[model samples]
Target: MRNLRLTLAWAAALLVAVSPLVNAQTTSEKNLKSDKKAAMSKETLPRPKVIIFDVNETLLDLAPLKSSVGKALNGREDLLPLWFSTMVHYSLVETLSDDYHSFGEIGTAALMMVAETQGIELSYDDAKTAIVTPLRSLPPHADVIEALKALKADGYKIVSLTNSSSVGVETQFKNAGLTEFFEKRYSVDSVKKFKPHPETYKMALADLGVKPEEALMVAAHAWDIAGADNVGLQTAFVARPGKTLYPNADKPDYVVNDLSELVKHLAATKTAQADTESDKTLAEQLAAQAAKSAKRFPESVRKVYAEGIETVRATQIEESAKQVGDAAIDAELTNWNGETVKLSELWSEGPVVLMWYRGGWCPYCNIQLRAMQQNLDKIENAGARLVVLTPELPEKAKETAATNNLDIVALHDNGSAVARKYGILFKLPAAIVPSYRDKLKLPEYNGNDAMELPLSATYVIDKSGTITYAFLDADYKKRAEPADVIEAVKAAAK
Candidate 1:
């Protein structure tokens, strides 16, 4: 009886000693859960120093390629999605099997697989030409350019991480008019792994000199976001149409319907974090500059400029150029002296520098004309003849040449037939037509009832009638630098 009582006393002592320790563990766990909840609900995340973008679907619109693929499949448009899914599936298979194949190869294989399933015969060459060729020339999403510009202005270093081969991405960006916005182009080719592979994201981080936490991966695919999240990087999911997040994957730090929405969210977050006084001062400065510029030009002229900027941004003018190294069309044009000259005839003598200008009324054109005149001697020394093409009438061309003292031939492209041949002619927007006709008397200068203009472009054509170099931009104010033009001429001469 004595021993039993001692044992009971010891048991009671042990319970008293363990009670506070158990309470402390429970309290600690509760605190951890509270902290996690706070993080999940946090309104602001630490801003990323670098933003890595996915190239396909996220930036470039692949919808146009769907039509080409569908046509190849006997107009079965429904097969496009299946083909794309198979391509992605096989790419992952390649990664998992420790093998490597170009994205183009995998895509072609996927096309063949889909064709076999449908009992359709498809040649590898035909499939690649029809489907993969279009991938190089996909157009950008409508909001991509503006959103990228905003992010750049807000001081974010943007880079592209794509599964495409290096040459493929280069051509893609060049054709999509998106090459200028990205700081660098990264391809999974270097690492031999497709995306969702940790190495692919790690390669981007290492190349960009950014820590995982300091970078944000922006993608349209939920798998991409989950991959980035797994590696400790922040993520923004752009929920493109017909896309959904992976049900089992961790949620991204931010989610938006599109890139434009993401830009707005980032802008708001930035404003919330920035110093109020500095932001106010910067805003006032911008407003003042805008007011000054608005007052400097007449209302009609301002409207024309505004409309021009908008139109050019919305149009795919950059890709309209005839591909480089193609034969230049043998276009007959009337010079200022009423003499007809064929482009081939000029090329037979030596290399030719062909330039397109708006008219004498345009200050930008005049600047470009004078700049070319200054480089005329150098052009001749490099064994090239300089010829300027204008849609203006012969009389207007003569006046422009005489006014600028330009000795180079100024050809009158009467109805912009030569420009049309070069695939650079575009009708003036309705919004700017009235200002051009009534305010600037454009019809009087061009001798035409219709308002049409060629894009401001310059080309260096070799003796073989091949276009060796081209500088084409829709913005009237941007012209090819004289030095670059001279260098191109010298290279063409060689």
Candidate 2:
């Protein structure tokens, strides 16, 4: 009964719409509690791979349901706030007492308790009909659909976690036209536990194979944010009508008045991050990478690689390689799946960024490949495609693709024939031959004992089959940067 008084106090505050959760001004302002944290609040939110949303007032408009619940309380429409708070409070009580009941059943029980307290004679059956009927047919708010579509288009995995029963949310989404947006929907019935219990969130994380830190929980209820924040997931608070953060809980990563605001914040943060990445030039990136990798290799191996780089520099091999204004070579090769690929046909759509590397065994190649892949989207957005040429066997090329988690189009240039056509092919240094063939198993990877490689080269060719840009480097450590290639691609596009 004591706890019930506290619940009613919160309900009264919510009914008035005059204060933050529990009337503490804000759960956020009080939770700061220190100067450093308040300052750190200015930091932009880190991007999340997946977003888990709470369905009730966060996604749906609960205002329409008040009429039905009000009808049960003898026309006392305002008591709807008290009934909701009571239902949530009792759900917590049910969990703490080691008992289990579906959320709908608990809602009915809460409605009965509210009526009994009001001195109104309401039967259990009447309470159930009032709460359960309107709950399932609630309409979604105005700001929901567009924000959900924006999130999906940006490649975020969206799912719902609701205290409502499975059939309950399904009917609501179906009625509200929200079923098409979510990849999945979860109900507390799956774990037989209500939310704010920690286990409910954990159940979803485990099922999705997502780490807590990799997910963001978005909810209108402050208690829902509290639960997710304590468990190490990123949180976003949606300040819907009558929804506020709990005064004692940690501040959410984002606090927005609607789902549209949430999407705007995310877009701004991503643009800021991209700007930060753009500030560093690719040459500076490679030099930093070379310095870091230099420490990982032994003196003997490093000496051989250094000598090989110097030898190529002395020979001036890049001067004879493919250059801007040259007619692009048309070479037929097999992709990782053993499908034929022609450079001429590939660039017919727009432009193609063709890069050739020795094989996956070369650390330099691996580093360069990863760097380019990180900017693959940017390249494509510039109206170009990227194709990687490697002398490794198709099977080994497929293995490399999987290992690096790269989705770039990779083709196997079987005997370095394409490299020779580009005039960038070269024989492996004698000093590195033994280790390259025996220890690194280069022969098996390429299905040959030719002991050869290519001067790391990249070319941007226009749709007319003319090489618009070329990057040829004799010093293996000095590969072309993706940033430079993007610029060249932009140039070629004109």
Q: Per model, state how many residue pairs clash.
A: 0, 1
- Which candidate should be chosen as best, given TM-score against the real structure? 2
Query: Judged by lDDT against the true structure, how good is candidate 2?
Result: 0.80
The deviation in Å at residue 315 for candidate 1 is 67
lDDT of 2 by residue, 282-311 (tens): 575556557644544556878988898777
Q: Give the C-alpha miss distance for residue 36 in model 2, angstroms.
A: 16
Give the alpha-carbon lDDT of every model: 0.78, 0.80
Model 1 misplaced stretches (Cα beyond 4 Å): 1-43, 273-494
Shift of residue 18 alpha carbon in model 2, Å: 32
Q: Pick the candidate with the highest lDDT.
A: 2
For candidate 1, write residues 67-167 as lDDT tens digits: 88887787887898899888887787677557899999999988877877787888999889878878989999998999999988876778999889999
